[model samples]
Target: MADHAEHTEQDKREKLKELVKDARIGMLTTMTTDGKHVSRPMALQDVEFDGDLWFFTYADSDLVAQIRANPQVNVSFSDAKQHAWTSVSGSAVQTDDRAKAEELWNPLLKAWFPDGLETPNLTLVKVHADSAEYWESAHSSKVVTLLGYAKAAVTGKTPDAGENETVRL
Candidate 1:
């Protein structure tokens, strides 16, 4: 039983990485000076999850100011097709690290920054993730998940819907 539990925990950790591996966009929520929370869709740079999340944005963007005022932020990703979702809570800081920016740069970003790496006001925002929570269906297939719901409906018992785990960095 102990071995099983250990494997389960390891699997959960790997699941978090798998879910975010293909997730290119995440909703970044920041607190404004007026104590209001605002969210914007931001493209995530580097699919690797190593306790930090990186994003590129204009230095003049309101989010940069919001992060300066309040570093606490939330970044969330969802994939409806796979019924997986993740929420990451962290503190963010904006920096003008040109070398880091060049390393994470992608040609697709040219759509936003016409001048590419030389774009003026371009900066990097790094979020030091404190914790992350993710949920995903436990069943191997949607058909199996649906059957679980149907069984619960007939038996009047709760369905084995999925697994949810929280990881602390």
Candidate 2:
């Protein structure tokens, strides 16, 4: 296993990217006006992370209003097959950056925005992630991990599940 101290900023960013690359969907949590937290699934826009996450939404969405009220948010991704999970904390803002929209655009998004890029109220939420924490199991296979767990159970010792680290951007 690799030591946490050995990972540089670039290494951490790469690791985080690797963990969440396959997780196209993530839950975005935002604070409401009443101080309550609301979470909804958002498609992770296909773009180089670079310490930021992007999502497509409507300009009039409650999410946009909430983000305007409080920029602090959290986005979480999980991949059961890999036994990996990641949570990113950041500040978000709504924008209509056409260039960025074009960069991250995919045809599948047409299902949401019926008129494609011309869809009225179409907007993007850019999340400037401050940090991310992730957990990943050492063994990717369920059978292998179960066996390891069984071995630990029989031996009454802790199982070496995996590595977990928090990376600051």
TM-score of each: 0.86, 0.91
lDDT scores for all predictions?
0.85, 0.91
Each prediction's RMSD to truth: 2.7, 1.7
Tens-place lDDT digits, model 2, residues 1-169: 4588988888888989887777779999999999999999999985365778889999999999999999999999999978999999999999999999998889999999999889999999999989999989999899998999999999999888888889888
Error of 1 at 121 (Å): 0.5
Off by over 4 Å in 1: 1-4, 7-12, 47-49, 140-147, 150-154
Per-residue C-alpha lDDT of model 1 across residues 38-142, encoded as one tens digit per residue: 999999996555668899999999999999999999999987777788998999999998889989999999999999989999999999888888877777687
In model 2, how large is the Cα lDDT of residue 9?
80
Error of 2 at 33 (Å): 1.0
Model 2 is weakest, by summed lDDT over 10 consecutive residues, at: 45-54
